[model samples]
Target: MSTTSTEPARRAGWRTETFARLDERLDRVLGATAKEFEKLRVRTVGDLMLHVPRRYFSGTELSDLSQLRVGEEVAVLARVLRTDVHQGHGGRSARGGMNSRLTSVISDDHGRLELTFFGKPQVMDYWRRQLTPGARGIFAGKVGEFRGTRQLTHPDFVILGDHGEIVGGAKRNAVLAEVTRQPLIGLYPATAKLRTWTIAQSVGLALDQLAGLPDPLPAAVRRQARVIGLEQAYRAVHQPQSKDEIDGGRERLRFDEAFALQLTMARRRADAKAHGAIPRVRRDGGLLAAFDARLPFTLTAGQVEVSEQLMSELARPQPMQRLLQGEVGSGKTIVALRAMLAVVDAGGQAALLAPTEVLATQHYQTVLKLLGDLAGGGLLAGAGPSTDVVLLTGSMPVAQKRAVKLKAAAGEAGIVIGTHALLGEGVQFADLGLVVVDEQHRFGVEQRAALSAKAAAQPHVLVMTATPIPRSVAMTVFGDLEVSTLKEVPAGRADVGTVVVDAKNHPGWVERAWQRVIEEVGAGRQAYVVCARISSQPKRKSTDAYAEDLDTDPGGEDIEPAAAAVDVYAELSGGPLKDLRVDLLHGQLSSEEKDAAMSRFASGETDVLVATTVVEVGVDVPNASMMVILDADRFGISQLHQLRGRIGRGGHPGVCLLLTKTAAGTTARDRLDAVASTRDGFVLADVDLEQRREGDVLGASQSGGRSSLRLLRVLDDADLIAEAREIAEACVAADPELIDPGLSDIVTHVERQAAGDWLERT
Candidate 1:
């Protein structure tokens, strides 16, 4: 097979050929429906070959009947001694009802084994005809013991002619030979109607068409990476002869995926560098220095380091596409503010886009407070130029929103902060130089691109996320953007203690957890009761709500029954926490109601606040020392960590109680235990990445779209990703347009990907 795109156009190659040309209805060949084929996304011969097996099942070695143990999956070849059927004990039909056992005794040279077929009369009849007295066959199933005798239940078997002699001569011999030759059975990721056998057969047909397939990766790159050719990798992945072949093939394909992504990103970076950006570089540092001087607390070393990096990037003419990642309560906001100040100091407008209205409002308040007199609407008097901070949100009054828009368009507002409303059609900036995105993952690629497009010159973009991303994940999901991490917590920040409360193992633990919350409230510290849902109504129930707990009313008449925030808030307020001031908060609540509830909690008027995961990010409260998470297992590790961060901001020791109804040994319990064991966000991030797949980290799973990665694993292929990145950087540096003959396919693929989604195309 030719592994080169440089081949003549006249050459017949699988890489350039469409599946329709080979066979329009590949569904017929695979014995699957069109819907099933669509699910696999198989449109070409390449796609068919790319549908690798999810797992492989090894055929058990044939074992003697006497040596078989109960619960052991084994294969046995024996001759049938006798067959019999008995009626059910409860006076039911022996063949169709409760008592249905088609029993047969099969014997090898060493001992005899019993076979039982239950509720499968057709199979029983077929087996009876095939496995008559002294007839031989091969059987495979899990061993079971009934009445002290070893037996096989619902065994899969193939009869080899008769016991005395082999019949059908060469034909029968060939069938046996084929079965004996294949020891491993591949189990593919298939739809309900499409079995693994059909997929395997179809793949076999596709492999035959792999001759002269042009390889996308250059020969030199493959040699340096130690990866096999494309054709070999595909064959080994689908029809491997040994474990080593499978490993080798997977590694090669993984490298290919990583390389493709890195090449696209490298080209994008190069393209951005070629474009001119309005450098918002500042030397006097008037606004930034003034803002920093007024801060009540000192900056951590990590924050200082990251802020310097951002300043340096802003000094360059190329637009800065950077991601600032930090753990909860790590002072990322301070670093972002400094960068924004630098831009504004250079006579440019800066915009901060938030994912939620609550977060946007909180950021606006934080920036206003931090800027102090320099934020000169009323406080500064005559101190230099007046820096007006404006807020715009979907829920804001129309008149107020119009005023903010006017200020933004006229370049009068030094800083503008808002949610998706900033991406609205009418919103525009006069000299937009910097764009800061908070909780960056919550927004899609299109949203970010839309904001960037508002600037006449490509704006300096800074994306910030409190959710710590593992190194491997950062390399793949955020490969296109430069990364800066804040690993240090600010001085005097209190440590949070996390505990897992096994509600299933100990029934009374739930009550004890609530009692802890009450005790925290009594101590003059606020408490938070986080639920998975927002309301008890079926139609209004959030996707994360626990279905079983939706109708249970622990508190009397006035309160509704549900595990949602409204029901939980009512139950706690009217029940155990009756004397304490409790308030309800959730996404379903009106903007004014949400603002009021948060304000009351912040002001200490509400002793306890019951809410959903809406409080997971950007909600800061110093007095809230305790958090009780109901159905904690439903939340991801990163979310739980962010929620825990809401407390312990006031230098008081904080406690996090995770209440889970799941059993101890399940995957859910394991995840909860991981969260409770440590407070390190980086460690928890790695664990989170392992627990879920790459799709979750990239936001593809939630969007109902396929992940950009097809073969690479963020956890296992870190080294390969690094290597591919180096090669891609070099490749793009040498040929920015990728017009080289060897790289034409890559250019075409990248362009196609970019046109499909804002993420891949960029």
Candidate 2:
């Protein structure tokens, strides 16, 4: 992998052959151990390489006591001149808490340091007994100020029988310098077995075997990109002597991954459309004509622009893969309906898929109102039920769903709207030509594929998102597919006045919220009260994260769960707004129940709806002009922007109140200030990316454990990511299927990642 330092030259020790044989035996033993290695399915050497380091321990060498700072990592060669051990256990806590303390003391030539261990006295005794007083050993630990004196605690210990144990016949003090001169060190992530006198350095040894692997790319491309092969990259990453080389190596690898991704997309697009061509859909100007005549107002420039883009794409014989990105209330559905009408006019059915039942019903109603007479007593005009625009959610009776499906199949309906129920057994598309997915981010790349697969020919797909992102990021991230941005709200849409209020004044703000909702309800309008958390904790990532997932308590009442969604709804329902209709909806509601409730809200049967962000994007109720978020400081910049997009869709004036507690940190406060300052989703998305990451938006849908990219922290990795994406593309363009022996290691690593079989060899 690297030509820097190949091996340790023999100095004066056991013959190299003997040591080599011992090393080989150990490797064989680890490999044959069968520690559920089968379950982990480490079936090949390649899988072993992808088992990346969670964090490396660099194992710092710090002998100069003055360089010993508290909370810093350091390594030292110390012998146990004297030793002491202590044991303790939990006596009794106020109510609930464990009790135990295990500690020890060991000294070297220069000084002595305490070793504290928690929860296990038995284990401490075994370790202390092994390193009896006067026994020499190496120690490693985090140095800290204790009683105004420098100290090392709970460090790794190595029992050295003689000076030879130091690796180069060095004393305790000389060992620091010895390690400092070397550029490589095994950095193991913090583990539970720190009491061990020695560890196998399992990952490092495994990685070494995986390094300096064969290349996998084509020679011509490799020469053009001027980049090192894969194994070299990994070595540079873990063993770089300087930051520049490390960055360069990581960039090459990141670029390679992105390039592979781009190639995959390109190949998929080509394969999907290579089949017999589908006919282009064009509106006879009949259904579209009728709908336009019934519209109450003109579309905004942003809406018009996206509508035209969809129209142009749909007009093509090749299936369109365009995405419609519109901020909340930016009129995305309107454009969808226009495109659907065109497809129906061209004798094809249209379908819109939503992530949830409530959203499906909401889209159904909006389309019903927007396309009033067209769906009501329309001359079927040869369009099917899918084009006629019916709802197909799980909440509906089986008979009703089947009837809807039958109508859609029999060409009774021209357009269909539903959740995944549309994908159920026996469901069929008549002449489905266009498919629209609301909140496209809620689904994955595969699910998106499944949605389009249901059509006869791969239908033209239009994915819509209310979460706006900066054009640059959208272009880079969505560059593979066509992206159309809806950046303007249609005329007559009123601006929702926004306000920021602290929770120290929460009661007052709550009272004011009550007054406003009551006043709005007096004129017959609904209100939404959103909350961040049910409770507060010191260790949570952030308060905004709390809002996304508010736990509910069925047994606890009175004040309700710490998350305000339920309680606030209860309070408002029974408070001054008692005369007005009010309701609650969140994840807790069953599909059918949520559907029925949200339907009522959409039809104006219910005046107010108090809920979490569940209704943030997909549900569009034109009359909902008031939104109140409790613990607003707990939300990220992007979320607040989306929440604000919910209101101000109608001609009437609306308002948004961001209520939070005074305890919010500067970051939270500053985020809120940004929210109070603007309503641009794209600008906010950039700010949000700076504040959060794609992870923030996709947190709930993660398939594996939390993401791990050493070079990519949302706050700092933008540049690295950009560079990596570029390089990955360049390198992959050189070699599509990595076959260069020198770079085979990279392909091996990625293959294992794709197979989901990443693990360590030793």
Candidate 3:
């Protein structure tokens, strides 16, 4: 094709050209100060061009001054008729005169308006010079009435003519011409000193250099995807002449982002397939069969299906990169145990990584209880091969931790469970076959890779998460990993009833909430009173002793402190619920204290556990049927869902009362209402994604500074992502290594996106 020959040259030119050549520097192009330019962070012409507008403003609808409402914002082009400086009528100051302000009168053909600015003498003089008699310019601001006259207070004005040593009048006229020619005005994200006008001017200069830029996407692929050329996209996004052009440009950019991400995922999958892993296949299901026989309940069909999928992956010589997602009480723990048993049966060690020490201990205890007979030295002692399970945490006694580590190093521990302590040095495994990461989102990609690197042979990875992810988010965020969903809860589990209690609407809601907790406790059911903060401290007096004399202190001595877990625990134990057993738990407590508190709560000795979100995961108590979350508006949607999931695990129905000070018709109220309406985590996940921006979903540790995705929205651009994924699959299938010259830029972009991630070494 004719386009092929010139494309390389264009690409080379764009890569080599500097911002200086394109006149896009703040100082040279927009007359900005050095400090202001430092805040812009635009280095090259490419960077300037990529700084797209946050929103657009229309310049075509210029309103006449006579038609402007008192509170409405309007724009007008007018000629200055007079400028005057007048002193205020207030009492004389220590400098022997009151403050002064500069006032200017400007008029259009039909009406006139006054502009006022109050400031120091030098600043007022500067404005007085700019608004000299007969000066013409554009002014935009809110219209206000000042003593029967329509006026604009400190309006944003752009002088239309050339001043002493500045640019010529012709250049000013050209800027005005460009502004009038465009259908919309671009409002860019800017710093305090670098306004939108400065950014627009710099972008205008950069657009002129688009002719020599290369399209990151190949021509055939672009045509197939129906995306605009990269050069045209840059032009239209920065300087669009029509709405259609803007839409096309935005779509192309979104596609480019999504395609790049999918390409990276595709390459990762291919590379993972190329690597060799030790097949963890076990012919004898002796230990697994025995473990399942001891279970109190039967496995759900969804769990069985997912277990089969995991077994199949474990039998392969390639590493299994799978994500197991389910709602709370979805039997994910049992499924993970089954996978671990498979590896153990194959004469290999399996490691279970938990995000917190409490969770690690919980898993260790649950596994110990489940493996009652088959756990050597038990009732079913000689029924099957004995499997040794060891627990490692940061706070374990030194001698005990050393014993656990020795067992792990010698391959004596068939299944090792621990928190981040497992990632420390000297924590080696004899032969790690499978790694199950619980609460996968709590760990970073680097930590996952570190665990994988612990073994000589590649290990099968099964990442488990209780937070439900929407289908669209999973496709984009976890695109490289195969997913298995466990939607069905085990039989006999009761659904939880959630209600939102507005403290603002009901005057006695707080007392009623406490009474409800008391009722639940009196009925022989435990309660969890969750608080946002661990402790509440009294407000200290002002630091400046002279603040009161100067009348500068904003007093808050009369305001009561917010309720904390400790405060609430003390109150319930000594005051209202004095007869009941109450305990406090938080992250600040020592490991032994935490363990004690949890043990008491689990054993039904503590009637109420006032804790923070540390109890959000893995602290299952069947007797605790009621939970009251104070300041529920402060918690995120997914977090609220997870906290509520801690209840209703037993056969009895659970109740979750969400207490909020937020009023009706607020966003916080809406979020609480959504959570109260349905127990479906998938629905709430969609709402969560909608509320927040698509962040570093892969893991925030991998992304250095910039976000993984820029223009693509996982929720809104699902269709585009799907299409790009299809094309990316084909592209990677054709060129697994991405060696084609046409994909060189794309390859580089992906590498940059990966940063120092473990995949970079691969």
Candidate 4:
């Protein structure tokens, strides 16, 4: 009792005194430059200190300028070889009436680069004098090429003396000295509005004002983990003397991020255990058992094992927070269905939230077909003890939606499945015992919380994703939730063969791909034609699945837009596969139109379904054995894997053609080749993680905020994350309430930053 009483006083004292310096506003320290710093989101002294340099340049080392790629932002130190000023076009005023140009040639040890600036005569003369022959300085800008010559147009630069000292006026030297004084010059992430030297000066000012930094990690944990303290880390990261110091500082900070995250997760788990949960124990001869007995096929051993784990956890009086990830078509839906039925049998309701309307509707149909008479809920003749299944979507008619809400509120609907509409108004549940989220990554924390709020008590949550996550990602991102993996695909599932149709080198391959689709249709099988967009309109946004796959012209070169479903459907239905029946489906289409297209394809009434990635997940058609993806290079690796998973589910072997205009030996083509080479989702998952920033993997994109993890890499720091998790669990076991003020503050800060998504608060 005395310990509890002192905890509040200790926390208050720490907040008021220990962290006061960190909480100080940047304006107090940085004076006028604070406004510029604020543009980078460094509003506080602590934020400024934590803004570590992205990379460092060594005064003793020089990089090969020849290797620099176009479109890359670079900071290079070079000596000016020559300078010239040209007036207008070929020394005469042409277009725009102000075409004076200042050009200079700069070179390092390896290669030469050209610099150009276009302005009025005064501006050109000023630049010409600044970039005279023999001048050595650091030039930074986006690498551009003109007439096959590497160049930086109107780049940011700082001249340096022979002794590596910045050569400038008193005020200029003062700002850049904080950045150039060390043996290793740090290159920070700078923007067009704020240069690197100004940010360094701001950091220096903030650092000088910081009186002290309280370490969040306990001394013993630091010793065990072999990491430095917070103060040393800040100094080493921002003003390092050597690369080794940079390494040490980065590791320590990464551990801080991991430890804070793990502690939050552990505390959440403990709090969840402390709460009272209604037990959803499965009973004998219940809906689950009855359904299982009538199944024509046997469950895989992996499925059976995962099912038992879920059943055991659900039977307990603690809310179940489990993440079920498996290979595509590995039967995660079956396992989730069994758990939902267990909750229904325990006199409760279950809700399945899908990311897309198509998936929700497909799940509704799949459940009905699987249950047959067991879903009658006493409304049908010769039905046993059963319950009703309802599908609620935003596109549903008002009457239909109202009926679903009434059934859900009255506890008549044993299972509820819907899109985001289920989280909207007037959706109540009599006894919500479980929630099953499909493609869990697509939904954010607030949406989950809203559904949980509908329950009288915290409902058991089972999130299922078809995109197989690497173990390291599973630990780092979903640490608070228990993860169950299913790797085995059910027996009799046919093999899927992937082929890359390079349209750039082999233009005929495009026609051949269409021919293959026609042949599959001729064989009494349906096919899918996937596109990156709905239409070619410039203002229309890409579908959610292909949102990140939009074409980017970094080199300022003309490039064609990605293939669109509407255009492709028109072309195929009129030109290549004109004899076959084809229907278009995309996000822009009305719900009724989309549903009709899917229905036609599923029932074999449509020979080909041309659509965007709306069918990326959970749209199953056994007879659809072929898929041809147009401009497949635009899609991500995991997305490509998920898209192909639609085919190959039936007993017949499947064929997937990836048509791309990307040339060979390019990054885009390599990604497509990797997807075509193997079908292992786990392997592809690791590759995907390696290619993407850790922030995206941790749901920072969904939350629309900076990533909670600034220094930690979910891929490279796997072992560090594992060790931190172990130490955090031990710390939580010792102090379940996180009474230590410093540690508690760290957890709170991380949670606040990632409030909407990353941590998934209990």
The parts of candidate 1 lying over 4 Å away from their true place are 1-32, 37-47, 57-86, 89-122, 125-184, 208-211, 283-285, 377-383, 537-562, 700-707, 741-762
Candidate 1 lDDT tens digits, 71-119:
5555565777898865443244544455446788988768889988765
Candidate 1 TM-score to native: 0.81
- Residue-level lDDT tens digits of model 4 in 651-746: 889999999887777666777888999999998888777765564456633322335566788888889889988988888898888877767776
Give stretches of model 3 more than 4 Å off. 1-50, 61-183, 191-193, 202-211, 377-384, 397-399, 537-563, 695-707, 741-748, 751-762
| lDDT preference between candidates 2 and 4, better one | 4
- Ten contiguous residues with the weakest lDDT in model 1: 1-10
Q: Tens digits of per-residue lDDT for model 3 on 16-107?
A: 22222433444454454434656445644555666787655454323256755554445566678999987673345566656578789988
For candidate 4, the 10 contiguous residues with the lowest summed lDDT are 1-10
lDDT of 4: 0.80
Model 1 Cα shift for residue 303 (angstroms): 1.7
Q: Candidate 2, residues 1-762: lDDT per residue as tens digits?
A: 110011111112322221232224333534543232333333333333333333222323222334333444555444444455544453533444443554455554456665554445555566656556666545666665567766565555555543323332112334333433335333322222321111223433554665444455455545555677766766665556665666666665555554444443443344445443366555555787677777888888877777777778787777788778876777778888888888887777788988777678778877887776578633245443223668898777879988999877776677889887876766687777788888865655445555566676768878888877554444334544678887776667788788887757457767777788889877877777776543233343322233322221111212222356667677778876787888888756887778777888878988788787777666677788888887676566766887777777777788888876644455566677778888877777777666545545432321222222223343444454454445555544555443343233343333324223112200
TM-score of every candidate relative to the true structure: 0.81, 0.72, 0.79, 0.89
- Per-candidate local distance difference test: 0.73, 0.59, 0.74, 0.80
As for model 3, its CA RMSD to the true structure in angstroms is 8.7
Ranked by TM-score, the better of candidates 2 and 3 is 3
Ranking by TM-score: 4, 1, 3, 2
TM-score of 3: 0.79
Indicate which candidate wins on lDDT: 4
Q: Give the best candidate by TM-score.
A: 4
| TM-score of candidate 2 relative to the true fold | 0.72
